[model samples]
Target chain A: MKLIENWFSERYSDNLQLSFRVSDQLLSVKTDFQRIDVFETYDFGKLLSIDGTVQLTEKDEFVYHDMITRMPFYYADKIPEKALIIGGGDGGAAGELLKLGLKSIINVEIDGQVVEVCRKHFPKLTASFNDPKVKLIVDDGIKYARNTKEKFDIIIVDSTDPVGPAEDLFNEEFYSNVSRILNDGGVVVTQSGSPFYQPRGIELANKGMRKSFPHVASYVAFIPTYPSGFWSFTMAKKSQIKLRTENVEKGEYFNLEIAKSSFALPEFAKKLTL
Target chain B: MKLIENWFSERYSDNLQLSFRVSDQLLSVKTDFQRIDVFETYDFGKLLSIDGTVQLTEKDEFVYHDMITRMPFYYADKIPEKALIIGGGDGGAAGELLKLGLKSIINVEIDGQVVEVCRKHFPKLTASFNDPKVKLIVDDGIKYARNTKEKFDIIIVDSTDPVGPAEDLFNEEFYSNVSRILNDGGVVVTQSGSPFYQPRGIELANKGMRKSFPHVASYVAFIPTYPSGFWSFTMAKKSQIKLRTENVEKGEYFNLEIAKSSFALPEFAKKLTL
Candidate 1:
């Protein structure tokens, strides 16, 4: 008798890959836009992958959610009251913003199957979908950004890689539309890809955002489950980027010191944004 | 006909691993202390591994060498003159120190085979071995630290993990011995493994260094080839750690802002040192 080992691997390129041993795969579905996968691993707990890329793991989701939501909230000029999240079907981004005393949150995700899968497989991340202050809309985020007349104090672009359905989200026309819908002193943040492996992700986002906003900068966070474990985020506003609050207390990864220090990039990464 | 693909992997644990596709195996030797292997990788260029763990790659070696050398050199009370390196058989650390105008450097490595292998495959890193200012000693670093009478301004422990032959290097007795051979106002730094996967590595180094020095702190750098892409280094001295110089210009990763921002830790990692 022979024992076969079960493993799931994400290939970043033809030459590099990361693998995890798994006991079972709980969910696999082909959505209208992309493929979504959920696995129960021995080390990283429940793992979620979209289009064959690791999106989040139960063990390290806090790092991504905390960084994406808290960095711009603390950097805003005032306490933001209303937010619009694009492409965050898992409800993690909305869940984090609910703790910031927001009056309303509207999450616009393109794929309805992604939300259905998360609601069944990942209960913790999707609990915010049921909140009274939260509104979930199943529609194309690009079209919604161009058509929405409702103004928001904060806009979060929580899309996947800048390919397939999310490619248009990193361009100038989408940002120009996004700029018109934001209220005064509004801030917009998006997740740029890994600076080590995908430098073009930051470069493209920075180039597009610079055309629409005066203050545009990129910062990095450590996400062990990502392609290189080094991830980046780009934030922009009409006003200067500065800390407006030191009272951000609901995060495992964000503090006032990190809010300031994360913007200091290494030389190699600095060249990418320029 | 069947075609076979060649690859190399580092098993960080039974459940997690990182793999790199190799075009050729340059060198593979079992030394008296550990196994040393060199490969020509497609994505990361030349790769070096000790005991099946990635020590360095040509593409990202600057990040590790810069953080290990320049962080302490800039944070010192004065410009470092004399230096001691433990287990840097590849001579990369010594090469970086030579650019800082050090008077002399003594590198004590336990495995002499690692030096010979690197001298042939990695010429860029081992070019400093032929310099008159460097003296390479093939001996146990544990015994050398316990018995050396030579006083130095800076000591760098570039050893492997805190297990196997390098187990004793992370204890109080070894640090007390290291304290005896340092000049007044001297600094010592060591590589403490990933804070995400191995928090004990930073905890142990912090506990040991606190017993022998007045000021000790740990900072992190991003090394994508390593297990978690996040790596840490702990530094200690008899005096306060203030910037003594802003003239560090030999690295691609070390800038003035990084020298200060790297010390700011996320909340989870901050608890590991305490």
Candidate 2:
């Protein structure tokens, strides 16, 4: 309880000082959503969805969920028989992965509070957790991947940005661990970084991926609410990893055309191949 | 004069009450470097380099301009020696087109305020205008296009969204006239709305493109700063188009690979095709 008590006394805001709160933070801005109570934090930043400030936007929810879930699933060219979700404490990624016809999944999340908050406020996002196919592990992703003996067909590092508990997710050791824990045909997809401002982040991520896997490539999609307005390029192994789409499943925003174009990085992106 | 007053008085934000000033009948939002102005009456927006926000981002600027200018320049491959750019105001398109080895160009911009602003604030964006190859036309695009009798190899519509005076740019008559004034094998490339949000708008635009040219294909690009995260789409006739590039232009971004990738549209976009 002291952990919560020590971090809860202060708040930070842009020079505007619009009364931001940080109680055991759960940092919530007093905006159009919640005029009051804020909840806890995971490493990267405050999960603002359950309380206020940023809600699951109609387009945002659909875009991120579909892109993150569908890209690697299809690219792997196989229905994920077994899966592991790292740092998705809020359970959204697990929810998406569950629908991919996976046999079972273990979600390794470091923050118990984020899991609890997501299970409660973001019902639609966390809905897939109720499925018996998913098992929650309230543990650090890096340690879990390093310690686990089980090799997964698919590993989704659906963590926050490269700052907090998720910082290690951006490191070489973690990616290498992912490669080690994946089966020969298995593919691991991690959100690299926004292609705009964080070109270097993606460059380093691509570098990390290149070191760990035989074939590595980046995938992109538009997310308006995100800063710099683009999402991280998802990297996957190239051999036998052709994203299969025999049935041509229909979705609101995604399809094979978008899939191909999303992976087709610009020349600037291609130049960053090194 | 009446149009100027009209643009100034009716300027307003989408949801928030942001005071968008109209200087000389064009919307001007003063920033650190230049003015982010909207010529609403013309149904297009202009970001004038009047003050602080003006930047010479060649790699970034070419991302939009070259595609807008040169893509169509190539599509109208036969004898597109002469061209007209309406509402580019920034000279970015004019600059890129000059690289095409076009014989002559007339940049017909209605807002002289923007030209002056760009010369002062956005030297890089406008500096390319000094090329003897380009003749600046400071008048309304609709009127200039309507009055011009000489046919052009290409007409690149580089205006803002379709809600301003450029709103008429979307009208069928504009296409008929553009077709009439276009020399055989002439092609026009107009910027389009995000096919993500405005599928209907893109469909309508494509319908008009087909109305004007016998051949029309939709193309896209990943412009991180524009609304809806991506910006820039093109409609062109492929009959005379020859996009196979031999020169590996010594640039940071635009290259042959991106040139081809730029024309590939997603499934969300495919639905909008005429």
Candidate 3:
């Protein structure tokens, strides 16, 4: 086979590549922090790529946003009022929090270019930035966590894979700072890579989270554009978390049944971290 | 991007393609029914393609085979003595059933080349075909269901996407024949395509199954090699199917927790076929 077209391919792993038919490459920029590229695809609609990796697609951003934010929210005993998001430059995690009527959400993102690109191209995610409660700050999340005296009821780390610019977010020192910055009974959730393809990432994150919190659990969700379509999240809190049984406003993906089911790991996944 | 090597690409949809880095093309045969191609890949091990679509891979076949066979078996009231598999020429579903102490199993495959190919290239999936209780029959599943007077306690329709050679298996008449050949309290499960990508297929299969059985439900499983990471299955039973809570022998991908969790559909999936 010969290549006659410009295809946007994300090399998910050494052997796997997920490619979308590109109608146009909307923007390409090499920021001081990382490379950012945005494209208009035929099926996935608009796509935002950071450092040759898919950040989020217009079609299925809800799956990632809903699972990462709402799962922690569902486990928390009380509805969160003040929250903090780390490295979600695409604004997905913050956007989900804004919908839940959080009083204040401080999104500390290191890459201003990612936020700028998403604001210009992806409205569904960046629209929350205009809300009064969401404060977008361009700073290192680890530095912010270490320096700030402010406390939060919920802390969400939406960083990229545990490599390059986002690598520090997965270490024990950062998690200890995150623990310091949270109020009593506060909860924290971080994106753990796919348990199937990236077991080492999940294990490292789980090991780091277990250092600071008494209770820690991991969950899985399906995001098609992601590698292996199986994504995991590691969460830690002071108290035991129960499934949210109440009926709330639902999105394209999340619900109470899925909330509980997301934590049910397969035997293969359960053995990954151990 | 430029392609410098031989890449085995499966066009999942009109606008998306899943490609694997191909190290070698082991076999390529144009059988009487469909094209069968096998390749050795970098990460996914050996790959099997039928009619240009992925049939199974050495790494993740357990996820698909275990969910399809185990779920129905879990719901059946009694221990299944006899079982029948339709269109699973790779011997995956039969392989799972053979693990149980079932009395007998008959696998009806439309194409013999798939069995021959899988038996040679993918031993993990085809090893159960040699079991004394397992019988392989080369014939159309619909014709076999219509002609055979023998009834089964469990019937598994492990066909491909409801197109081309497997098109007839999705119709109402075929489901009616399946209901006829099942014993009282018998359970049936079929692969409905990804609810996100192929809603029409899920809807049609759900509609057909609703015609024959009193209880019908759809569940999801994640298989990265599929078009979408999320895949759906439609199951119908004579009585209310309760979640299996008892401890049972577990597989790498299937356990009581995953068996119950698989039925919890996301909101988008809930609306896909409804």
Candidate that would win on DockQ: 3
Candidate 3 collision pairs:
none
TM-score of each: 0.98, 0.79, 0.96
Local accuracy of candidate 1 as per-residue lDDT tens digits, A1-274: 7766899999989999999999899999897799999999999999999999998899999999998899878888889999999999999999999988788999999999999988998889899999999999999988998998999889999999898899899999999998998876888999999999999889989998999999999999889989888999999998888888656674788887788899988888888999
Can you write out model 2's per-residue Cα lDDT over B27-99, one digit (the tens) per residue? 4565332356433222113333222222223235656775676567555556468988888887888877777
Q: What is the TM-score of chain B alone in each candidate?
A: 0.97, 0.75, 0.95
Clashing pairs in 1: none
Better of 1 and 3 by lDDT: 1
What is the i-RMS of every prediction? 1.2, 9.9, 1.1
- Please give the range of 10 consecutive residues that has the lowest summed lDDT in model 2 chain B: B10-19
Instruction: Please give the DockQ score of every candidate, comma-separated.
Output: 0.79, 0.24, 0.80
Off by over 4 Å in 3: A1-4, B1-4
Ranked by DockQ from best down, the candidates are 3, 1, 2
